[model samples]
Target: MPRLLGVDIPADRPTIISLTYLYGVGEKTARELCHKAGVNPQARARDLQEDEVARIAALLDKDYTVEGQLRRQVSQNISRLRDIASYRGMRHRRGLPVRGQRTKTNARTRKGPKKTVAGKKGVKDLR
Candidate 1:
């Protein structure tokens, strides 16, 4: 197992893809990190020694605000939205569409499942 940013990468995957398991690192960032660390993109995590994993982790820690810092920043952004009472915040409060999307017929994803009205049962004499 290769550990980076305190998260372990499964030895089964290639080194490039495995690094994406980190909080802020994605495919592009992973590739960049691999390039920076002098690690082969096709290399497997299991093939790497602890020092190599440490190097990548150190690189990320030195250069980026991930881990705890990112979480705090994201939380602060959400808090700002809530504090402002803006349209987006109002939409959040109401559970309605927020991003200027037409909700007349669409936006079923955020609105959740539609409720079907019950039809009249069979009636005699058209009553």
Candidate 2:
């Protein structure tokens, strides 16, 4: 594994794919980083020279927000929303779907497992 910006990238993968192992880096950004760093995107990560790794790391530090920095920035944004009492912030605070997804069904991912309430007894139970 090649360590870049404190993250270990898989050595078996192509440089482009390896770069995506970092938080906030996707295919498009990885491609762009390879281009700007003058590194071969198709080259295996293990084959990259020290200079090439330094170049990519320098470029990321200078031009991108990623990893812990990106995570903190996102959390700050959500916290700000919550502080301001925004609807989206409320959803985040409440752990509900924030993108207007209907909660009537299929929101199990956000809503978590069902908390079933006991059913009411029928009229026959009263007799």
Candidate 3:
């Protein structure tokens, strides 16, 4: 395993694939970073030289907000929305879908397990 930007990437994978193990780094970004660092994208992570790993780490540190920092930033953004009382924020605060999806059905993922409501008794039983 090669550690890059505090994440241990799989050594057996190609550099491009391994780089995606870092948060906020996708396939396109990985390829671009490899190109910028003058590294072979097809090369395996374990095969990379120390200087190459250093170069990739340096590039990430200089230009990208990832992992903890990115997570914090996203949390802050949601908190800001909540403080402002936005509709989306309210949805988030309520633990419901924030994208205007109908809650009547198919929101099980956001709403969690169903809570069964007892049906009303028959009119004859009310006498």
Index of the highest-TM-score prediction: 2
What lDDT does the true structure give each of the candidates? 0.83, 0.94, 0.91
Using lDDT as the measure, the top candidate is 2
lDDT by residue (61-82, candidate 1, tens digit) is 8987776778889878767887
Predicted structure 3: lDDT: 0.91
The better candidate by TM-score, 1 or 2, is 2
Query: Distance (Å) between predicted and true CA of 6, model 3?
Result: 1.6
lDDT of 3 by residue, 1-127 (tens): 8998678999999999999999999999999899999999999999999999999999998988888889899999999999999998898898888987899888998878876657844547555
TM-score of 1: 0.72
> Could you tell me the TM-score of candidate 3?
0.81
Could you estimate the TM-score for every candidate? 0.72, 0.83, 0.81
Candidate number that wins on lDDT, 2 or 3: 2
